[model samples]
Target: MNILKSFFCAGLMSSTMAATSMVSGSAIAAEVKLRLLETTDIHVHLADYDYYRDKQSDKVGLAKVSSLLKTARSEAKNSMLFDNGDLIQGNPLGDYIAKEKGLKDGEVHPVYKAMNMLNYDAANIGNHEFNYGLDFLKKSIKGANFPYVLSNVYVLDGDKDPSNDKPLYDPYIIINKDVIAEDGSKHMVKVGVIGFTPPQIMQWDKANLEGKLRVEDIIDSANKYVPQMKEKGADIIVAIPHSSVSTSERKGMEENASAYLSKVEGIDAILFGHGHLVFPSKKYEGFPGADVAKGTLNGVPATMPGFWGSHLGVIDLTLSGETGNWKVSDGTGSVRGIYKRDGRKTIPLVEADAAINEAIKHEHEETIAYMRKGVGKTTAPINSYFALVADDPSIQIVTNAQKWYVQKLVNGSEYDGLPVLSAGAPFKAGGRGGPDYFTVVPAGEIALKNVADLYIYPNTLRVVKMTGSEVREWLEMSAGQFNQIKPGMDGEQALINTDFPSYNFDVIDGVTYKIDVSKPARYSKKGEKVSDGHRIVDMMFDGKPVDPKQEFVIATNNYRASGGGNFPGLKGDNIIISAPDENRTILANYIFDQKTINPSADKNWSFAPLSGKAKVSFTSSPSAKDVATSMGFETMGMAENGFAKYRIDLSK
Candidate 1:
């Protein structure tokens, strides 16, 4: 207990304290150096360019971070680089390869090609890896020269048998590495790597994963596998957890599992991913057992490299004694930033690695060629600066595309001639992604890059049957995006709840509604109903009051159809058409089918009446100048953390 606190405090002050302690240590004390290199959620970022904008960006790319990795490795004698997963399926490059240029038999994925060049020691699979289906994933995995480690996911044995199912990949891998102890004595070390991703994959990507695979909870997988690795003569065990640190402790079967996984007995350290966030910083200041400045939780060292290769995660551990009897005496976790987003400006640290840039040069050029192709022309500008405050055109185009595709699929079926509805969420709204994150396509020719910007992910299309009341409940959940405003209150109130993910704020296109922010939210993100205050009010459909039993076919994505956001009244059984097409393709094809696209939000959603001045403040992009007041926002000017402040007036 004393040792844990001592190391925690030592790491709190960082290197200076550790250096001071080392000098005062006994003369016989032995010390050795080891570094753990991690790359998580790379998401096919091969170059420092934004495919959506069709321009070079200093903020992202694996090639840029690969340069940092080489420098980091050069400083350490005993080091191993491991990718923690989510390497595929994020931007336009991943989409073009998935939908346009299909990977042929034995062809290596561009992500793996670059990763292989980096010589990753081991890796695991993240939820996004299944976006292209099991076959594509298998072929991509085959391209990696390093060992693939995954502990939880399993494949069914037979059509009628699941009890005897086996793991889809190896549960763990032990790598033999060289280490130099005190007195310059060299010894061999066995390092075991175990990995776990979100068990909710069975729900998020059900169409491709159901009836064929099963997943175990992350904590369960760690308890079952860590002991086995320990028994296999591993001197040190490193856990590659493709999950975020949960907000709470010992919360059973949650999506973010790093916090709980650290409590497991045999685990030495944790490498985090899947949240697309940076840790060991001020972001997790008061989190349980998490020392942000020290980069640890429960005395166990953990690190999560920022997503899209924006930052490289580096952990340094000082080992003592011989390699076979090595013990981690001191540890610290930190991130190397490639581009620091100071307000609106970004500061780049380094350029792309020459080797990686040259290796994937062909694919990089092809991806640009694909993104630059003109799809159609737009009469009006499309941007997400005011998406949350008002019904938005960026989302309108998506809903229109989904409704068009779903109507075609059910032309002669039982759902034919049924009232079709679609749900679209603003993907590029300003939040954790910063001010420049919002999509801005000017009034001109629309290209594949514009389409990619409108819809950021590669989620598949799905049509779900829902009742009117259920639809209202869905709107109520979406209303969680706003904060409660009291009537007659004088001071300015926060309008948007930053904790709510922008992708889950689905707005129904065919319906007109008002969100009463004075009421408390009906349910939390975990589907737990905490209060009964109704936020959704005046919900009407087809110019008439909607009935509780009225049915409608709603077009959405696979993630929402199978309950990714825990919205009320949603289940897989309600899905009507699970179309095997990417939403990005549907959007692009829809725009191309119509020579000109002129989409404008129909004012379907609004804030309900309040007694006092209907004033609330929100943050958006500083570039929303010409369209700010036109979209119903009173621009306040640029705020902190790369966001522009704005005020919304419901009385306007």
Candidate 2:
């Protein structure tokens, strides 16, 4: 029987016995006391507010989690508090400290300052730690109070010399904690903690970490080192992985370190992150026992808390003492949210530590002042609301800006006369992320910092040369953004896959063409062409089909140019020119060139046909209600799932 069922049955039997002995009231059963505490994917949200927008965000911030930690710790005698990586980056405070109040060599970062106040026992590194570079990472580590472990990432030792410049971190750490055994005897069990960062960092953050470090596959590293940890007197093994389990086959192919690592031997528990998902509660396809509530990883407890300090994961472990070693008998894991009041929309429950808050208070103020300083002006509102539906004003402005910048730089050159198609994705369309996440820029003075908020990614502009055929294939791959069209369907079928990652669906504004949902997609998510011909049927240049031999100049971010998504013909060799400036800068320059710019939805991009009405769900903040309704959908009443849902008519 399952743990909950067993507990229920025991209760029922006890009640029955009590009823039989009703003539004499019997003693009630004692409750088993065991507690665990955890915090995952804090992402350096130390304060209770969103420093970027200078507004309060109830969903995130370590200040809120601090209250949850204190209360949970108070509930148990033997409780272990842990953090599951991504502790660095995300907020303006982290950026300000790293870029502005530059780290003194060998000095601790402010994140470490706040983390130290929490007294975290162990922590794992997330991929974002490598975003700045290796030197910056090493300096940040110097400030950490706890050990950072990684089993997969290794520094390549030149000439295989042990004394030579070697890797920065140890593979795993064994933590010995005293606990009462099943027999009620006090004992010490050495819990082995191993950490792994996704190997895809070589591609994702190629600029910073490439050649300096080497990352082996997570499963390979786990199989290699887990036995060693066990041999070295570790009673239990826990994996702190900065990766998520794959939900769709499309997402599965994109490096999920946890799915493979969980199946490895000797691993007792797996603490996962990186795709920024909540787990044990939400199951993904291909993840073993993922559907099982509070499931065990290889018979050991496994969990992943939601990202950005919104939730804390706890695992209460029970162990048995045997000779010199200990083994896990059973355990339960749960995810808890941080809130001040019991009701929904309760203000952040926890208060920031006075010392930690004071430490970075000046840095915070300086960042605010810097962000408020205006760099330029915008005559119109630059919002990301309708970005996904059509040629969004925000994206259109960015594209126009990039095209203008490119045209000026290559004036009178051979590439200058070529027609340019600018591609941009909506960076801030609220989903999973709460209401405050949407990018809503007021019409007025525009600052460089605000530009950063507009384009959160550091992607640069690059021009790719592709034929008409390649362009159609590109759109077909993007068409995967919507659900597959069923047989004999009509009307506005729920447009593409809502979770297909807005970045992958390249919306080209300059060129106009109608998407035929009647046809099948030409390519798979990995860029493999499907057997069915092509879905992008009507490719036009000037009211006529594009010449198959003619080459078009496509402007896009460096990530897409370097084949970030498996889009065809956009990879390495197709590049015609690479701009040194970031896409956001190009966009800013474009807006400056065109004093008054107006962009609207082209209605060229739509999904395949639909059959019967199906409920399509996605996370959105309250602010997105108008935008969603404009796209033609029945807005479902709001639920407390941290996001709103809507029903779209699919039956034609």
Candidate 3:
């Protein structure tokens, strides 16, 4: 007989309702309820404020989620709170603490000050946790009141096998807790918790972890240690993989491996994230081995809350049987949002936790003042509203800054005299972040916050050398951001593929090309060749066609140069220059040196004309009308979810 008990499947319900029904009026059946609460991918939005826009926001903040945490804990007699990582870095507050304020020997990070107040049981190591280097990460986490658990990261001792290596943190922790049973008797339940991070951290943060640390595969690490946790008197095991749930087949080292991790034996429940998406919602209704209604992946209950403290993931497990033979008989998983959206209005579901706000008050104010200091000036407004549709000034400025910085570094080196191109993407273009997420820097003094807004990530500058043929292949991979449209297709076709992340759509400067949306995409989002389509046409450099064998240097971020998005041909080996300065700081320096700058797109790229009068449409912020009309786009009135629809005639 299998020791793992089969879960009772049921429709989704509120955490309170599930807790009330499970524990109310029960016989002496030795039944117990264990409520697990999770917060993942917070990205350090400690307060209800948008640092990019420098204003109060109703959409994100941990201060607001704290109230929801209180209510969820109140509904259950036995509860444990766990953070799924990505807590130390995201917003300007995180940057302020990591780059400006600096963590002293015993000084606690502001985010930790707030998290310690909430009393997190344990936290998994997220990929972004290594963004500020290993030293900063170590000092920051030292202030946490709770222990951090990770099974994959290791420090090898002259062994090739990870099993022989020493772990950076404890692989798992078995917590012994006393809880009231359905029979009104006290029972000690030993709950085991284990964690796994994306193994690709080695590549993403190569500068930080290359020689010091090694990461094992997520599934392999789980298979290695889960049985040990079971043998050590753990009645139940909960897995917290800082990874997303994917329906893709497992081939090892996948960034999203929760679906594969769920198949590991002894994993009674799972809390997964890193995709910044919500599970148990309609978005994941049809994924393989997923029961959205029951909130289970392969019959194991799981939950992934939205990022930036927007939702609280709740997993309630009801175990029944004798003391030593207790098993999970029933469970339900769901996410509770801090706010709700009704058209353009935001309805707050919970108030900000006063205690959390008070804990981080000093740091929050300092971050604001630090972000407000002016760096330079911009003669024209820079916005990412039309970054995907056309060559916009927002991306143009970043590319220009990158090219300027790289040119100085590689001036007389072995890579000198090569044609330098730059790649930039819109990080703030709204999708899941809502309409207010786009960057809008008005024509005036450019502050440090505005520079941070343009480049949201803390990616360092890198230059990769590739042949012209390989560069085209790089652009081909970015072309996956668009959906294929048939000529003379009925109705308006969607122009952009919303499923494709805006960050992956790289716009290469110093080259001109046209994207033929009528043709099939040559590459998929995963860099797999699914079609033989050549969507890039009329590619030119210096008023002539680019030679296939010609060599060129491309300035980009470390993430892309190190195969962060799985782009073709370019990897860590080809990178010639890995500058220590961050791209945001370079941009700030470029702007400061210029004193006053003008940002205007060179119109290096556009959509190829269709044979017939085909029309395509995409949604953007309602405030983007002036920019759209100035570019001669036809407005299609208001769209759903407070977006303004615009149509483009491809036949033009």
lDDT of 2 at 326: 59
Order candidates by TM-score, high to low. 3, 1, 2
Question: Candidates sorted by lDDT, descending order?
Answer: 3, 1, 2
Q: Give per-residue CA lDDT, model 2, range 400-461, as digits (tens).
A: 77767766766787777677777777777764565456777777777656676777765667
Which runs of model 1 end up more than 4 angstroms from their true locations?
1-30, 159-163, 249-251
Candidate 1 structure quality by residue, lDDT tens digits, 256-297: 999988899977888988888898878889998998887997
Off by over 4 Å in 2: 1-37, 158-166, 179-186, 247-254, 282-287, 339-356, 412-417, 486-493, 524-531, 542-544, 570-580, 588-652
Candidate number with greatest TM-score: 3
**RMSD for each of the candidates:** 6.9, 8.5, 6.7
Query: Which tens-of-lDDT digit does each residue in 1-652 have in candidate 3?
Result: 2333322222223344445534553233578999999999999998988998898877799999999999999999899999999999999999988988899999999989999999898889999999999899999999999988999999866657656778988989988867777545666788899998999999899888888889989999999899999898888999999999776778888889999998998899999999999988998888998899989999999999999999999999999864556689988889999998788778999999888889999999999999999999999999999899899899999999999999998899998899999999999888888877798999999999999999999999999999989989999999999999998778879999998899999999999999999999999898899898799999999999999999999999999999888899867999998899999999999999999999999999999999986889998898999999999888888887678899888885
Give model 1 RMSD, 1 decimal. Answer: 6.9
Using lDDT as the measure, the top candidate is 3
Q: What would the TM-scores of all predictions be?
A: 0.93, 0.83, 0.95
lDDT for 229 (candidate 1): 88
